[model samples]
Every structure is written in C-alpha cells, then in structure tokens.
Target chain A: MSGTESPAVAVRRGRPRDAARDRALLAATLAVLAESGYGGLTTAAVAARAGVSTATLYRRWSSKEALVLAASAAFAADLEQRPDTGTLEGDLRILLRDKAAGLTGESGRLMRALIGEAAHNVALAEALTAALIDPVRDRVAEAVRRAVARGEIAPLPDVDLVADLVIGPMVSRFLLTAHPSDTQDTQDARGTADRLLPFVLRAVGGQDASGDGGFA
Target chain B: MSGTESPAVAVRRGRPRDAARDRALLAATLAVLAESGYGGLTTAAVAARAGVSTATLYRRWSSKEALVLAASAAFAADLEQRPDTGTLEGDLRILLRDKAAGLTGESGRLMRALIGEAAHNVALAEALTAALIDPVRDRVAEAVRRAVARGEIAPLPDVDLVADLVIGPMVSRFLLTAHPSDTQDTQDARGTADRLLPFVLRAVGGQDASGDGGFA
Candidate 1:
C-alpha cells in the first residue's frame, strides 16, 4: 500500500473511484462509530449518512470491520511514526503527551470503539494486534534500540517487555477509566505519564541519563 | 452488601427469594456473556436461559448492566481476597499467577465483554472501577503496606503509583495480545510477572531487600 493509494485501490482495478466519496464514507463511519459505537454501526447507515448506495461503500470496503479498520488505521498511523528528540526520555515524553492529546478527539472516539469491538470480533482483534498494537510496539522498540546505541541507556534482557513497561500503565488507565475525550481527562492522563516516566526510566537504569528529575 | 445478604436481597423486601435461583441466573448470565458477549446480551435472553421470566429477572436486578455487574463481581470478589504469603515477593507472585489463571475460562470471557461494553456504558465503567478495579488496587495497596512494615521495602512515593506500575504491564499485554487462555500464555504471563517483580522492587529502592537475582 503506497502512501498515495487509498485502501480501496487494491480492490478496484481501472475503475476511477472518487477519493471524495471514499473520504465521505470513512468520515461517516467515524461519525457513526462516535454516535452509536461499533455494535450499533451498520453499513446501510454509513451509506445513508454518506449519501451513497451500499454498493458504493462495499465496492471499496467489504465489511464493516474493514471500513472501521481502514478508518482507525488512518488515525493510528499518525501515532505509529517514530519520534527523534535527541534523547529517549524526551522522545517518550513527547510521544506520550501527543498520544494523550490524540485520545481527546475524533480519532480517540474511533479507537475506543475499535478496542471495544475487537474484544468480540476475532478478525478485528487480529487486525488490531497487527495494525495498531504491533506498530506502536515496533516504534517503541526502535526508540529503545536508538537509546541503547547512543549510550543513553544500558541494554536489557527483553526490548518488547521494556516497551510494554513504558506503555502499559497509560493503556491500562485509559481502558479502565473510560474517560471521554475532553481537556480534563487528557490533562489527567498526561499527569499519569509524568508520574510513570521516572519509574520507567529507573526500570531501564536511565536515572543519570534521564537528567535526574524527581517523579513529581 | 453484607456477607449474609445477596445483592438482590436489599433491593426487594421480604419477597422470599431463592439464593439457588440467584446463582442459576448469574450462571446463565455468564453463559450468555461468553456466547453472545455484552452487546448481544439482553435481560430477556438471560431470563430465557435461566428458565425465568423477564419480570423475575427485573424484580431482582433493574437492568442488564446491573445484572452483569453483579455476575462479574461474584468472580472478581474471589480475586480481591488478600493472599498472605509471608513475603512481598511471594504475595506478588501468587497474586500475579492467580490473576493470570483467573483471566481464563468463563470469567475471562465475561471480563473481556464487560471491558468492551464498559467503553460505551458509563454505568458499567463506573461499576467495574468500583467493583473489580478498586478492590484489586486496595489489595495491592494493603500488600505494599505490609511489605513496608516488614522492612521488605522502604516506601517514599505513592503506593497507587507503585501499584499501577506492577499491574499495568500485565493488563496492557493481555489487552493487546488478546492471547487465548492456554497453559502457554498463562506461563508466558507468569514469566512476565517474574521479570517485572525485580524492577518493581528496584523502583521502590528494594533492590537490596528483594534478595538480588539477575533479570535474565
């Protein structure tokens, strides 16, 4: 999948598909996801909302899961990008703060719904593990490797385990709290990141390299 | 809320409810939850499965959310009970292993569904926080207190933060991996606990107290 090619391009051959129409359908999916959640979302409703026939929607995406995956991927892709901030601590803080910010908007709504649906839908669950979770894990792993290479932190036993250590608390808090996308919850999540940062650094033996700041 | 009283008891006066019947209903609810998940669950379906009328189910529990919460709480209660293992490490290892064990079978299915449904249902979210999340957190906090008192670890920072650090990775891993409940995954999760334990001890300056062992 090239950056320019939409997910729909693979299914359709030479037929000229309207990019605007695809955007409309995906936007409708997001709206339906936010308004009614994944269980309540239907392709017919999305077609109606997007001012298109069900055929048009299906021609691009085969199932509701596919459409939702495509839409969620658009948002998660932005978060999957690796950050370069000279230091691992700086990069992590920025990544976490940006993540908290992302969880307070339309993208966050889609994510919350996707996560909910993934619990019951095996296909969606697998897709989520591959598309969203793996990417973030890979990005974090890359960051850790860079940190180790720069002598910012000592290498440890398992990179994946350490990556999980860094992101685990924030993800757990977010899932349990079920906070809506709002400024207050976003700030609260950021506060949680601040507290966890020190421990995460200490877990990896990055105390001196992290510039020696209190967890407060 | 008393040990002698069922949750259904206080809601209705001297109606002569059968505790056996309540157990059957909750069991049916779990069956439905495992088969249909929370979104597909209905009071009517639960009533049918329990061989009772909708009115009978409603008489004891006002809503589907309430019934599910009560059912989930029944299982979560078992997990909330404090384990006295003579040492913090022993307590933590047992707790983590037991928790991993619990995240399997019928209870795990219900938990996955409730967590999914709770994303959209505020009442379920709050009830989960109060019933399941809070109790486990409190138990951990109590464990930390005991450890500190026994001089196993010196406490300076927040207990809740430390608690989160301990449980967060496990929760996050479970959510992300969506691994099936088998001996392999259970063993893997326990291995994760073993790795995280020392870091947790180290985080609280318990490296010397934790009886040093290599993370490898």
Candidate 2:
C-alpha cells in the first residue's frame, strides 16, 4: 500500500502523527475564528497559524464548516460531564461552574463566531446543533434523570425544555446581553447560577436542598 | 436667514421630512441588514435602497452605528408593550406571541446579524443592550410587579434574574438553536410559551392559573 500511495496519503498514513498536532490545528482554527469570526476565517489562515500545509488541513477536514465543527465539538466535549454531587443543586453548581469557566477567552469567542455564522449558513447551523447543542442537551437530560430517580424532582414533562431553561439565562447573559469584562463575566456567571438555583428547582418541582424553603 | 442658509442646512430644515420618510429609511436599513448581515450593511446601500441621498441618511444619523441603533430601537419598540391580561400567564403568552411574530423575516435576520456584529463591536453591543435588552427587561419587571400586586406570585428576590429566566429559553430557541421552517417556528414558539408557563409560575411562586397544578 505504501509503494503506490499518493504523497498526501503517504504523509497522512505513514507519519507518526501525534494528538498534539491535531490539538494545535484545532486551537489554531479556534484562534482564527476568535480573531476574524467565521466569515473572515479561511482554511489557509488556519493552516498558516498551525504551521501546516493546506493539504494537511484538507486531509484532516473537508471544509471550513467541518473544521469549525470539529473545533466546536472538541471544545464542547470538554465542558459537559454528568455530575453526581449528591444533590441536584450541587450537581448543577459543579456543572455550571465548569461551563462558565470554560466559556471564557478563546472558547467563548469561538462560540459567538459560530453562532453568528450559523445564522446564515445551513451547514454550519446543523453542525452546531450536533456539536454544541445536542451534547449539552444529553448531559442535562442525564442529570435530570438522576435527580428524578433519586426522588429529588418529579418527572419533567419535557427534558429538552428543561435543558433550555437550565442553560438559557447563562446564554442570554453571555451572548445576547452586553459583554462583561472577563473578571466580571466569571463573577456574574457564578452569581447568576447561585441566584438561579431556587428558580430552577421550583421549575423542575425538585426539593430545594439548599434549605431555602423553595422560593421564599 | 433663509437666503443665507447653506444648501445642506436648508435641505435639513426646509424639506418636508415626514414620519413616512423616516420609516422608509429605517425600513431600508433593516432590509439591507437582513439581506447582507451587519458586516455587509453600508449607509450608501441603505440610502440607495430607500431612494435617498447618502447625505440625507448622514444628516439624520451621524454614523452607521447610529443608523442601526435607530433601526433596532424602532424594531424593538414595536415588539415591547406591557400587557395586562389579568394573569401572569396571559400576559407572558401575549408578549411572547407578539415577540415571536415580530421575530420573522427581516427582523429575525437583522437581529441575528446585529448579534453577530455586536460580538466584535463595542458600540453595537452597548446599542443592543439599550435598544433590545433594556426594554424587554423593563417590560418583564412591570409584569412581575403586576403579578405580585395581584398576589399571583411572591415578590421575586431578583426581578432581573426572573427576567432572564423568563426570556432565556425563547432566546436560546430562536437565536442559539437550529432554525426551523417559518411555520414550524411559529408553532414551536407557541408551544414553547405554553409549556413554559407552568414552570415559570412555579419558579416565581405564582399561582398556576392554568390549573395545571404546577408541573404535574
């Protein structure tokens, strides 16, 4: 197979490609997206930033949307994990804190750019749903299921809507509202999550383990 | 004074610039923004589309940001009116339905584009908060006050947080989630508002006037 393989195929297959290179390329893609946004980003720019040839980029991903989708997916994958912290509020605090921490600097910028671009690009929109929205939804559903099973909450009528309710305020604060400074953003995120917990518990018909007596 | 007036000054002062002309120009700005996104919108293009001179546009608004701010404020103004429908659920339903209806075609596209642009532009971000976010917040606050006065809900600890909780899901659905067809979008909007009412009432400690028994 190596004897007649094309140079591009040989480079891809024969080279002992490490995970670091993939990480570098994806990071470069995210950086470019943050700096230039989706419309301004180019595969060439990403390749140049990553110190790789365009052929290397093409070998890994088919198009700009694919490259961005991969970057977004990797970023999202890091942010979502089902947490069982003994209580629903504890679980939510951990998850939301981690999510807020992750949604800073490059990751936040990449998300904003992708969301902006997705509005006009059908392929990007579908890719975003798969890469970003769906995973978060799954994670929230699992968390909700655990809470329900533990008798913390009644069965939710719509887990997806619950996910939206859980995530929406943060999204609104970060994306739709004015951009806060990084320090303020982090502080605000934590505070918002704390303030939001009771409402979320009530909304889900869950026991408020915080002992605040529900929405008092 | 009339004889010595500069041509520009005279044009500004003497021309019968009716509300219709202002509406036409703003409408033109929104149309261009919808079609081309914010990055692609130009004052020249708006003027051309509105069949007016660039000077006419410049005379009305100092810059592109000002022009867009005016257009966005006008658009938002039309969407936000405090509804007193006797119950919190009725008020929210009317508000959300009207908002969803307005967020179609040119308005939706313009919002997406503005959101995309505001990510990078500080002025646009500030303008967006003022034009879009503030009015909605005020309206939500008023509605919450009415609900409290009616003994429909407890006094919310944080009205702003309540506003975020109320609006976040819809914002997430329309802006961050995948786009549905227009018909499906309207139907989904209505369904979401319906489904969300119970949770919202529960969250706010409001009596569930819908008789759904609060998350059953």
Candidate 3:
C-alpha cells in the first residue's frame, strides 16, 4: 500500500501538492502518536500539528482509526527493507540487529503505542498485521528461500514456524522484558545475535557455519 | 510480592475487613482495565467499581500506576503455577498450552493493557518484568533444572535465552499477530505446542523424546 495506489492519493490524482501534504500529515500523526499516545491523539491535534484544517484532515481520513492506520502503514513501509547476506545466519544477524536498534528508539515507542491501542481496537489490530507483521513475514520467507536455494539447508516444511523461531527471541527480549535504555547497545544486539545463531541453525537443521559449537 | 508483604496491606495489618476490601479493589481494577484499557482506567473509576471512595483508593494505592501494578501482580500470581510432566518437552507443552489458553481470555486482555501501558511507563515495565516475565522465566528455569536432573538434557548455558526461545513464538503469535477470536481454540494451542516442541528441544540441546523427529 504505497502512496500512489492508496485510495486517498488515487482520489486526488495529479496533485503533487496533496502528496506532500499527505507526507506531512502522516509524519505529524506519528509524532503526535509518539508523544500523546493513541488514546490522547485526536484529528484536531493532528491537524494542528500539520498546520491543516480539521476539515482537510477529515477529507483525507474518515476517523482517528483510519488516520492512525494510514500513518502506521506509511511508517512501516519505510522500514521494510531486508538485507541479503548470502548465508542465513548472516542475513538474520543484520535483520535482527536492525530490529534491535529500531526497538530501542522512536520505532519502539511507536510500536508500543500502536500495540496498546490495538488491544481494544480490532480494526487497528488487522491494520497492524498488514502494515508490520506481514512485511516481516515476507522478509523471513525470502531469507529462508535464499538459504534453501543455496543448499544451506533442506527445504523446510513450515517457513512461518521457522520465522517465529528465528525472530521470536529478539522480539521477546525487547518488548516483553524490561531493560534500561543505556544497556540496549549495538554490542548487546551483536552478542544476542551471536548467541542465538547456533540455536537457530540447529533448529533449522542447518550446520552452524560459525563453528561456535553451539551454546557452551 | 504477595498481599501480606505489600506495603498497602502491611500498613493495615490485623484488619481482616480491609483485606477483603483490598481483593475487591484489585479485582475491580483488572475488570476496569480489561474493559477500558490502561489509558482509559482511572483511580476514581476503580474506586467506584469497587464500591469504595476515592479517599479509600488513594489510601490503598497512591496513584493509578500503583493500583494497576498491584492488580497486575496479584492477577499474575494466580497464573504462575507450573506443570511437571517429567520430560522437558512434556512440561513445556503443558505450560505453553496453558499460556496459549490464557492469551485468549481476560489474562490476555490484562497483559495487552499492561504491555501497552508499559511501553510508556518504565515503572510499569519493571513491574511487569517482576510480576509476569520473571515468574515465567523462573518456571522455565525450574523445568530445565528438572530435565537436567532427569538426564533428559545437559545443563544449558543460558536458561533465560532458552526460555525466550520456547515462549517467544507463542507470545508473538497471540499478541503481535491479528487473528479472529473464534480461531484461538485449544486445538490451535496444541498444534502450536506440537510444532514448537521440536525446535525448542533442538535449541536447548535436548533430544526430541516425542519421536516426532523435527519439523517435517
């Protein structure tokens, strides 16, 4: 769901002015969301932040939910890039490292805000799956496909399960566990990736090319 | 922390009438939290729901955060009972299955509300680690210890990492992914546990005693 194909943009075709305005609005939405959270956010506040009229905001998105969903989708699209590091372990390290880094900053705040809102909002929950979880799932599948093609491991029966096994620990550590902000450093991410690599490789039935000989 | 050790209850020790009131207040807090989420909950509302005055609520819990944390801790203590099925896989299956079931009900709602609030509140986050995550980690460690004692597996280097590997996927599925409520059935929990057991065994350097081999 890119800008060009979005219904809001399609309805206002040939208007580069509105496209720029849309970006400002989305950015403003994210900013407001990060600061005030989903419950505290309002269309009027978003409009005020974007220097637009409430009428203009309403014309673009029907409700607060729609605006938040659109903003989240736009934001997630920007973070959807995945690396191809040849080996599965290499690919996972870069991807998870980036994820760890992301979870320590604004992206993390945005996620927590959205997740909090999504708990009571079914439509928002679906939007989150489409915007965030779906993209991650696609990236994991691609990584697994490359590994299989390169003969790193045999074809897996369930790539989704493999994805969960690979990505779950990082998510758990960042989201479910409590840690001081100072401790969430790049070195921590690298060490976590290093420790998890052998277990991941073993789970996927691939040999640990790192020669770490599994956890001691 | 249990009710007896809680400062709120400790101050009012030897008052049996207040102990029952405290339970009612904590239960009311959870009920309100489930319905209104962390953002929508108020000390006044919780007091009203428990048929108590704002003064009484303040006397017991100084603020909304304190009230929510107490309620959450008490609620979590009820769900902390772990199973012992002899084998590591067996114990995990039962535990994860119970977790899956819990995620579909009021416990899930409570957790989501807490997590949503935790993203913004460091105190809440730490409280959650103490109230929820720590207990689960303890249970996982106990299970691993039992397995080691039984010769089902060698000692692990990091039981916390092992715990993450085992529990993270299920949490990711229920919390992060969007699914229709009707589909969150017991069979699904069983199937998920079945699929994850092999990977968990492999990750912890234990043999898959269930004879399922690995993921097909």
- Please give, for residues A31-51, the per-residue lDDT of candidate 1 as tens digits: 999888898999999999999
Between candidates 1 and 3, which one is better according to TM-score?
3
lDDT of 3 by residue, A76-184 (tens): 8898788898888887766666666656556666777787677667899899989877777788889888988998877766668777776677777877767633346
Alpha-carbon runs more than 4 Å astray in model 3: A1-14, A44-56, A155-158, A179-183, B1-14, B42-58, B82-84, B146-151, B179-183
Compose the digit string of candidate 2's lDDT tens values, residues B7-82.
6775677667645677899999989988888878999999999998887777678899899989988888777677
Model 3, docking class = acceptable
> Per-residue lDDT for B1-216 in model 1, tens only?
343666566557544455767888998988898788887899999999899888778877889888998988776775666878778777776666665555554556666788788878778888888877777677778877888889876664556776666666776677655554332265666677777776665565455234433333
Residue pairs in clash, model 1 = none
List pairs with backbone clashes in candidate 3: none
Q: After superposition, how far is residue A157 of candidate 2 from its true place, in Å?
A: 1.8
Provide fnat values for all models in the order shown: 0.42, 0.54, 0.49
By TM-score, how accurate is candidate 3?
Answer: 0.83
| Error of model 3, residue B125, in angstroms | 2.1
DockQ of each: 0.46, 0.56, 0.48
Clashing pairs in 2: none
Docking class of 2: medium
Ranking by TM-score: 2, 3, 1
Rank candidates, DockQ, best first. 2, 3, 1
What TM-score should be assigned to candidate 2? 0.88
